[model samples]
Target chain A: MTIYENKYRITYEAFSKFSAKLSKANDKAELLEIVQKHLKYFFNFKYFRVLLKDEVFLKSFHVFHNSNNSPEFILNEFFSYEEDLLKNHIPIQHSSNGEFLNNYDQKLNLNNGKLWAWYFKYQDLQLCVSLISDDEKPFIVRDIEILNLLIDSFVTKYQQIKLKNRLHQKNVNLKNAINVIEEQKFQISKIVYNQKNTIEQRTKKLKDQNSKLAEISRLNAHNVREPLSRILGLLEIAELYEEKDLKKEIFEKIKTSAKDLDHILQDIIYKSNNAIEKLSSKTPPTK
Target chain B: MMPDKIKIFLVDDQKIANFITQKLLQTSNIDCEVLAFDQPIQALDAVEKDLPNFIFLDLNMPKLNGWQFLEQMQKNITSKVIILTSSSDPADVEKAKDFPQVISYQTKPPSREILQELILG
Candidate 1:
């Protein structure tokens, strides 16, 4: 509606476009470096610094900035009222007269040329923006709004890059675990196959031994009876001279033993014949 | 009661087996005279001199097997033979019947019942 309002709206639109330019990144270091470049180029700010306090319960802060040199804040004064300031739980960006601000200015010899600061409530850390124009009174309100806009966009980009790095590392670890498991499975299957082959070989060997034992037993039984039968028969005839009455009983007993010899011979013949039959069957039928 | 004059012959390749069988024969006929032979040839050679009425023979042997000895003894003596062995073969039984003098076949240290019937039946 008004010219000043129109100019403010245009600046806001430009800042909004810079904020919307956040993209997925691979690492935290690269994301922070890009945010430093964006503050210098997009916002046209001479100096910008971001001090991030460790969110994992460590009371230390990491500062990323356009300048490589550390700020001249006295360590004791900076930490003196830090606890109470953090516990207040409100955005400290609007506090131009806070204890930390006065302490920081005194330590840095700062006369304030467009110095702006914002302390994010979520992270107890400060974002400092300055025009670096000496001898000019600081445009604190206007620059603080600009610094807040830049910090918002930077935080969003940092989070995006951190999430990307975590997901990428997780994917790599998962793939390595799967490869290890698959190799183990392959080795186990090979062992099982070898064991099965060994069992089959042992079974075949036992069967062969059993068949050989059977053959030996049969051969042994065959050879023992003939001489025994002959002896008994001769004894029977011999008994006629010594014991005439016992001759008949000896004859009957000899007859019974002869029958046993006959039975064993028949069994040997049957077994040998069966062995021959099996051997013939195993031989591929000749035309 | 077997007569003391009844000559009993023991035959086998293994010396221990021959000794055990000879001992068993002594228990049965207290007065019988027992003669042990390790080789088939030696037994066949003394068949006439020994004139044993009761002859125990083993079939599995080195030079002359029981079957060969039986054939040889058939020509020399009318002695009765009883096969003593650790075997149980049907082929052996069939061969035993082939010899007319082979009257009975007895298995190892022949069972008391079988020996009692053969000697005292």
Candidate 2:
């Protein structure tokens, strides 16, 4: 088999194993282990790290086949390069810098190269993916293309897996919401039981208050009208007199007092009408 | 029988506007006999007896709006019609373009200079 055919078979077999593990994997740790295993075997990188764009600290696991020395220096260099790439219009791959520009270098870095870096782009995230390998075989351009295709597939697969997890969580949340609603329904009767006595007490108190206020208002209106009627009647008689100057003065006084009383009565009537109108609009008119 | 002077007819509903326009025409260097009319129908009747050289008409009125008055007056008299009104509406502004007799549309109580210019220019 050609190198491509070999790599394809290896990647396919590993993905099959990972797909099986992905179904049963409960936590991130189990999922990560399966992921690391498949990624290491298939992509053949010295170091492999998955840095979530949302995370403050990058989360990655590395495996070096040839050397015991860790590729921590390579990651430090990559962090600045990644920031620059995002800020400027620079592409991912820089030959001098310890990173991969396109998808191919990522696989090359993992397999046999001493230094390699890659980034996976999504809607709201940029994953700084990298690998370090020390091998005689130079990274071929065709292999890089295949690697680019492979990572793209991986990103799609990753999204699908995450969506499935979200759906599962959503089902659990819906179940919890239903349970809470059922519990609330059971407790709702008790709330109604408690509110009934309080409502009755409040209603009785309000009625008593309303009656007392009405009685006071009636008494106040009676007291006001008696004096006002006497003044108004005298003014009306003075208005009918033959003397124009005297008649005008009394007429003006009576007009002012009469207007004040009319205003007060109209205001009370208007307020009552407004209240009734509001209540009627809210409640469907019963035929 | 009439004096040797150019007679100008002012047609507008606003008495003050007509008064001001009359004053401007009187003070203007252009020697003209100015007659003011608050009622457009009365003005139309007066114009038939002796048509003036210029007729300043207010665009908006109660009985007969300036446009209709101009149409009726145009049928009878050969006076140069000029629209004068406080209305800044585009429709009213565009009235001058449609009416061939209308020399210009002046925004209310036009300056004495502009009034003189309208009559002489």
Candidate 3:
């Protein structure tokens, strides 16, 4: 193949590999790792760093990659330059300084390098990406397109993971709320059932007491008056007849009836005492 | 035809109640012929034949209670019935309301004043 066609063909092949690996990524770490591995094909940079925020999830991701090393994934950590870029919504291109490189020049093995950074807003996600390079392995303006594609694929997976976590939390919360309500309903029904039992018991006891009281009142009236009426009648007759007639005819009957009345009253007192004792003996009902 | 003197029948389970009531009738100076019977079964037969002016019937009895006597008397009940019980129980008084022939309900010891009012008045 000719050199021009080879370069175009290799570029297409690298992008296709990056897209396929990014699509298979399950999480944020996997997405960043895939991008770090394939990004070298598109550019020859010493370091590439990205600060990304998902506004919907309220989470920020920091992916820092040193060429020929595994990518480091830091959550919600941003450099001063990255913060400045985010605040100003601006882009920067300057000669490499430790401040722009977040004071990591000794580890990155860089001196007299060029630094490039840009801020971007895409569909509720804000991203600021920084690349460090020197004359030996220079990063051109055209390489920004490949960086943009890598960020887009990484963010898609990150947002999905965030949404899945949130959905699971919501489901757990809903289930617990339903369980609490069911437990409360069961307790309330138990209370109601106990109350019903108490009411029925009280009603039955009151009926028994009422009937007993009625029997006592009715019995006393009849029993007490049976002899009492006779005594009153004899006295009335005694008052009518002469004193001599009273002694023989009325007095004997009066004595017998008065004795009978005394016996009936004694019986009534004993029965009333027993009834009162029975009423007080039962157990008290619960609230 | 009406009798020459007022006839009062005393029907009760207690012999003493009938005796006391009969004596009260004598003491009251209300000139009435009093027929006293402890046995209500016999009293009902006598009452049916005599057809007295007033029948003073006691409530509680052995074979024939005052209510049973009243029911039996439904056929030949020409006389006025006076319910004479130990106590004027509201139940007894209310039941007496159903009998049109029962003119008065009196609680015993048969008072001369009550007897005088019933026969003479």
Please identify which of the two predictions, 2 or 3, would achieve the higher DockQ against the true structure.
3
lDDT of 2 by residue, B1-121 (tens): 9557888998877555565566567766878888999999999899999788889988668889887887786665678888876555565677568778888886653676887777778
The sequence of per-residue lDDT tens digits that candidate 2 reaches over residues A18-64 is: 66766675545555555555555455554454444533343444434
Off by over 4 Å in 3: A1-164, A284-287, B1-3
TM-score of 1: 0.45
Report the C-alpha lDDT of model 1 over B1-121, residue by residue, as the tens digit: 8445767788787565564565455555545677889888898888878788778888888999899989888876877888877665667878899988777886664654565466554
Q: What CA root-mean-square deviation does each model show from the true structure?
A: 15.6, 27.5, 8.0
Better of 1 and 2 by TM-score: 1
Query: Weakest 10 consecutive residues, lDDT, candidate 2 chain B?
Result: B14-23
Of 1 and 3, the candidate ranking higher by TM-score: 3
Q: lDDT per prediction?
A: 0.59, 0.63, 0.79
**Candidate 2 versus the native: TM-score?**
0.35
Which fraction of the native contacts appears in each prediction? 0.04, 0.00, 0.74
**Chain B TM-score for all candidates, comma-separated:** 0.88, 0.91, 0.93
Model 1 lDDT per residue over A205-227, tens place:
76996889677665544454444
Q: After superposition, how far is residue A192 of candidate 1 from its true place, in Å?
A: 1.8
Colliding pairs, model 3: none
Q: What does DockQ come to for candidate 2?
A: 0.00
Q: Comparing to the true complex, what docking class would candidate 1 get?
A: incorrect
Cα lDDT for residue B72, candidate 1: 83
